[model samples]
Target: MPSGGSTLNAENSGNHTLPSTLAGVDPLSQFLTGPRAQAAFTLRVTMDPPFAIDVQDQAALTVIAAIQGGAWIIAAGTDPQFLAAGQAATVRGPAPYVVADAPDRAATVVIGPGQSCRTPAGDHVDVTMSHGVRSWGNSPDGDTVLLIGTYQSSAAAGQLAVSALPPLAVFDTQETDPALLGLIEREMSRPAPGQESALDRALDLLLLHLVRASVDRADAAGPSWATGTRDPVVARALEVLHAEPASAWTVAELAKRAHVSRATMASRFQAAVGQPPMTYLAAWRLALAADRLASSTATTAAIAQDVGYSSAFAFSAAFSRAYGVSPTGYRRAAEVS
Candidate 1:
């Protein structure tokens, strides 16, 4: 009953068209496509005043959009930011933060790892406070309403983009599209087959839009990887690297692809991207491999070959040097976490 003109329930979803794959050649699109959501955690929350939730879930990324009233996001050391109706904020995580009606309000609920909910006094509250399907809050008809989407497994691929953002990036009402927000809100509440996948794609689209908005801002403080996309030459080269991380790329080859000379490509790339092309490629490949290692059952050799490494041994050495852990150890740690 949202913008798409069909209920997301499975009974009607068969006739509902899935969104087209994001096929843009830009850096953000490429980054998102590689390690997009598989089964994201999304919820609608309603609350009243004098409420705060202490968040320590260590999720990779979270998008919090205000659907009704407003709330304050308080990350350590940074001043609290407010999200009024139709506004949104993205929180890059693994770090703990808090959300409340007022910046000074104490948290009454604590969200722990794996989204376990408890009180500050350590009594579990998830089941006790449940509202209904994919919804949770202190009050059923509270003045404030929020939609929260968390990306848990996309951390490795998202690091390049997230690193460029501050702990929180707030979007004012004018910057956010109301129709898109409504679509997400509607799809999230539907009890339909493939609903998880529907929400996953929707959340990915929202994140892509937010990254684009952040980069387009005149006062954006994002790193070279984000800001560099504005340059045609650097952007083309980035597209090449991200699109073909497994390709055996050289500076001359990259320059040729970007329609620039080798020397020109090298200088401009360094100035704009903050690293040599090969170095960036290596990091990208490793990031891809790391995510695969965590999320799939692929063998190290298979993953190595897939990401352009000559052999598992070579990949292991490079991965260890960069991540400070062997691939096996990294997988073990990921499983434990």
Candidate 2:
């Protein structure tokens, strides 16, 4: 709850407070927090009709909101999903996709890795198409206007949450908050101090809302962990795990804390979350460790202990097995990137 980025260790863990990153968070919020943005790329695009942009940037996540007109999201082997005015959609990536005025429109600009823009023949158009501050398009007053925010792979924290998304998830007008979308659009147009941080927080909120909507929709396809929060027992168990990940948690302890029999807890957790309680906790701990390794200067041993590993050797073995790289090696590679 502190303004500064201070972490509360196990001694203070009993207070049920945690670092800013994981304090009093829900299951979805804990995972969604992984995509925290830093100087994220935010853009407003105004395009004429019959326009298509071939996106191959391989961003971890992209949020596209239709401000004025609409666009069609065309992914390979899936029906095109349209975002009418006031609607938004999130696209998970590394895979290529297209946003077009119509499904059949040919792409005139190709968005390559690093957010580089070029024609299909590779003629650079990044600067040529710039409309204004954080804006891009073929025309300054194009009929169709869209607000876009992207989280590049390196900046993303929650690998587990990102991995669980469908390639493209659309949120209709009823599912989105117009005020938040307006805030993002307005913020994108302004050049001010701390604007990047402002936009980043707004984008995080947008993603959070979208993911929450997905979970609430019974017919919508969402991660099992997100849907599991609907169950009181599982939600309580998840709250304990997230709030005090460094605790020496056992299934029996979690069951006891949730006021349920161990068997009931285990079976219900598996049924709702698709993983046993202990198994999920292990993955969750490792995920927290991985995020810390990339974002902090903490020693591996410290991070291991913070994530509930008994020893550095044990943490290293488990981390290596899960990530295919030792902690030091992973840290080194993260630095290079």
Candidate 3:
């Protein structure tokens, strides 16, 4: 935990009973439905030393905020973007990123990875961030303070729905759904009343709301490659691929899923999503297989089976074509990271 942040004694805090909507869900599963979120985080920092954190990353994605004291988030491999107070950010894209103070002292509250934040100088601090469907930060720092939240697929749904998030957006918290923010705070900070598990579920609800928010933002912004997202036809096709990448699929199958003619779907989706349907599916499958290979002890062939490849050699060939590196090499690089 950082200097001022500490565990809350939910038992001692005034026992705030849950609202009517949350009564039905287990604290953990509740938020997955887009309602009844329970976990939230709020912090206040006044610069002096910039903060950064690494996400444990079992969860799919996280959103960052500049609700008060401002800071810059430098994506692990991209340029730094400034966030003033009351702004929000979502980085559910490829590689992980970093955040810090330009002048050596900025503050931020992050959720997603259950790790700590670091300064630009490589200084790190332990931070406790919860992940589920929904997580939130309402730090009213008054400078570049950000309100961040996270959303991911269920444990059984591993990286299913969230990978389609559009990376580009107009970073502003005022444009978000007020109900989503308020609900996350209420559930996350709720008095335990003998229910810590309930808090986890509340966080899930907040995450679902975030996905909806992302969709709205995508609709408004139209399309851009930087967001790593697509228009409606492409997004729908993506949903199909994400839902069942392991199943045998083709351009025609994806077109049917999106309710467009195969040729129409092929051209439109490629134009909007930046990859042909088959290419995207193959790449997405290989990407997931690569992650499984890196994160687990699964052998190359077994990993292939899980992601629908017929053999390790076949999978490796496809993976190499997509990633320009062998699966083993990629795993080794990931290990080094």
Candidate 4:
């Protein structure tokens, strides 16, 4: 497939609701609906064979999917993984890595701040070949086509999502919703009005699909959060926790909600979530508060109340303890960055 052949199209069949167990546990939904994710950064890269690019240490999570030929991903401290056409990979960063036709190929350029690229010797390497909208690379007719979706915010909720993932994860396109990818590809090449907004939504959907597919692989060894969603009792309790983060939930109350004995619920929740009920709830509330701080214009007191805290002082203390920064300070830093 040629790079220029990719076209942006309107309308798609990818719009769908969340799964039953995952309905209220919509982690991706929360991430996307939050302020930072709304401004998601994305790119469409086109390249010929014998190509390789390295991205330096960046505290961002990237979703890379191929649309044309194949490529190989080599993240620091991990083995090289190959990605065929239609396949996708998530590269968790704060570390450097390389993407190329093969593992042996050295990086020809380094991607830096603002997605700028330069030769290893520090000479600027301009991506003069632009194929379609938001697209750039070595050639406009490059054989290898890639869609890159990035989530670079350091917000607490965003970090929580990254914490549940392995440093490098891959899944086949067959496991993804075809329509979502189709919509992403179609929208990537159009400079139409509100295109950035459209791309943000599409990228979020694609990330959700890829992450869910990775977690749902038949192999049982997966994150406790993902595996817990499969257990009826634990799933129910999780749904409650997610649905009502401000409910001031207690262990017994959550157990009643899950329709199980306190002891039984405690044991199972521990096994499935790797944490006790109250402990999990505390973490969840803090995460919600963090997202509210970064994404909303609500007052500290209001945000605190929304996440179960009745006293603004108590919320500030807890928020500071968990994040080492006051809520206002955290919001300020996020805004500055």
Candidate 5:
């Protein structure tokens, strides 16, 4: 794979209803404002000849939905991979790559990101990206259109501060994933007035589902994040922790609740959940803390207390260490994402 974006033919993407703009403007952007974290920035790139996105300066994770022609993506780095339509790829770490409707065929690829992504223009469609990096289409049969959206990463998507994603990644919309595509069409076709934000939220969820599917496919064994909960005992322990992350829960207590010896609990817990019991507890606590921070206006101290922190400073430090953002910062970023 070369350091560049990839292309997929229309055959690659499951069928999708075209997005409609209101009187030449995207009505979809209105509803995607808060950290329900949705981005609806899209472009219909109609190219006559071959084109490519040169991603050298900026690094991002993109979700590409191919709607019309045949195309594939090539990953560029020390280790590169190529993905065809109905297949998605995720790129992390720093790598230079480009996507093309290569070998003299025309196609479209939709590029989007989940958490952390930065484009020089946050709200532009179809214009050549001037930030030294760019993505485009190569046409062999006819014109091509690429739907693209880039998001800020959780690691650095705070407020107006720009951040690059951890690495370059891509996710393909499954041929069997018609339900999700139908939702996309519905969102694109919904009547405006009040349906804006809700549509964006749905799109955000759709993107999340796509990533999860890709992760599931990529795992030869099982999902790393979902490791611990399959066993009944470990699952019960997790349920207890999740149900009451704010409660004072010791590993010993969790083990007892799960009806196992502490050593066995710890071992199974790590195997199933991908982390030691205590570490998972802290991580779960921080995750819930982020949800609270994003969805409410409570004071940091109050949120800390509610999520099991003794003080605002301790909570903030833990939250930052886990999610790399202070509680306040998370709230603000949630507002913009």
Candidate 6:
């Protein structure tokens, strides 16, 4: 195996132990409940000079973080973007792109399904370049090093978490999630029990970090979901809604809690969150419902009650309208796909 390289599998990595204190954390608990980051395809690539790889797998999401040296990324329809050490970039995919020593360098290898690789001349290079586990590269000591993680099957909630954002976004050096990075690095090579589970969880946290950072930037490119948090009134309202999605909340009630008049709250919420307060609440409830449906085997009626629907039929209708599929159908599709 190449140094600092390992393929992580949930079954092979062993059972992970979690602290009792972290049991009910909303988003984190939801992420741990299902297929959010279960089978992450991760790799550490080490390369020397004149190296470039074209990624064609087009996974749902691809995250590239620099570890050792700087690299250039040529995203589709975009100019080359340089990633210095300690910086990271996320590419929303199904689109092919190139990562190389320099933006001008052509791809010498193509990464395909199952992470198999082949040269331009149709020569198989998987075994020749395979370092160990999930590691693949030209040399273990190459100056340019990167940690790549791909989410092949994104969970419903995970999708909702990153609903806003363009195809390609980069996190500046200052925004790097160092805590999660350190945990991943520490567990990357441990051949002990539950290492795979630990790695998967770490990777999930890393993805969450990237997604939140993308939204938090709130620039011309930032998503409204993130920018909404910038408004104190809207942020407080959001916290209330997220904390009690099952509550029958009205705009007047939400406004009362936000300490703003109904009219002012409505106007500010619409301005900041890009939607009326009630509309955002409805969407948030549905998003929570989707997460439950995808991650749990609860009855539709039970799930409906948890998300504030009076009847299963009502919940089903709303879910269908929002996701284009019934609760049961969505669950089945999430499992199979």
TM-scores, all candidates, are 0.83, 0.88, 0.50, 0.86, 0.63, 0.82
Tally clashes: model 1.
0
Which parts of model 6 have CA positions greater than 4 angstroms off? Answer: 1-35, 121-123, 164-166, 177-179, 215-220
Model 4 over residues 157-202: C-alpha lDDT tens digits? 5555555567787678687666776778788777677777787778
Per-residue lDDT tens digits for candidate 1, residues 1-337, read: 0011111000000111111221223345545666566667888888988899999988778889999999999998678999899998989877888989999998899998778899999998888777777788888888999998887645455776655567788998778888889998988678788888888888788877787788888766645678778789998998876666666678898899988999999988888878887888777777777777776788998777777776788889889988899999998977765
lDDT of 1: 0.76
Residue 157 alpha-carbon offset, candidate 5, angstroms: 13
- Candidate 5 Cα misplacement greater than 4 A, ranges: 1-34, 43-49, 55-61, 76-97, 103-146, 155-176, 185-191, 194-199, 211-223, 320-326, 329-337
Ranking by TM-score: 2, 4, 1, 6, 5, 3
Q: In the order shown, what is each candidate's alpha-carbon RMSD?
A: 8.8, 5.6, 12.6, 7.7, 12.6, 7.2
In terms of lDDT, model 5 sits at: 0.45
- Give the worst 10-residue stretch by lDDT in candidate 1: 5-14
lDDT string, candidate 6, 1-337, tens digits: 1222222100011122222322223443445554566657777778887978988876777788887897898888777788888888888777888889988997788887666688878788888887776567888788997888887656655665565556777787778876666666666544667766677777877877776676666463543545677889988887776566666677798889999999988888898878877777677667666777776787998777666777788888888988898989999977675
lDDT of each: 0.76, 0.77, 0.49, 0.71, 0.45, 0.70
TM-score of 6: 0.82
Query: Can you tell me which runs of candidate 3 are displaced by over 4 Å?
Result: 1-44, 47-62, 66-87, 91-208, 218-240, 253-261, 294-298, 320-337
Q: What C-alpha lDDT does candidate 2 achieve relative to the native structure?
A: 0.77
Q: Measured by TM-score, how close is model 3 to the native structure? A: 0.50
Model 2 lDDT tens row, 172-273: 898999999999988877778888789888888888788778778786554367767889999889888777877767789989999999998998899888
Residues 1-337, candidate 3, lDDT per residue (tens digit)? Answer: 2321111000011122322322232212222432221233333233333455434333335566453467666655445677666555666543555556672333354423443554335445343332222232222222333444443222212233343345433356655555555554454444446334444443344444444566456353333221334367776766655555566777787788878899988888767756667766565556456556555676887767666676778878877876688989877865553
Off by over 4 Å in 2: 1-24, 31-35, 154-157, 162-164
Which sections of candidate 1 miss by over 4 Å?
1-27, 252-264, 292-299, 328-337
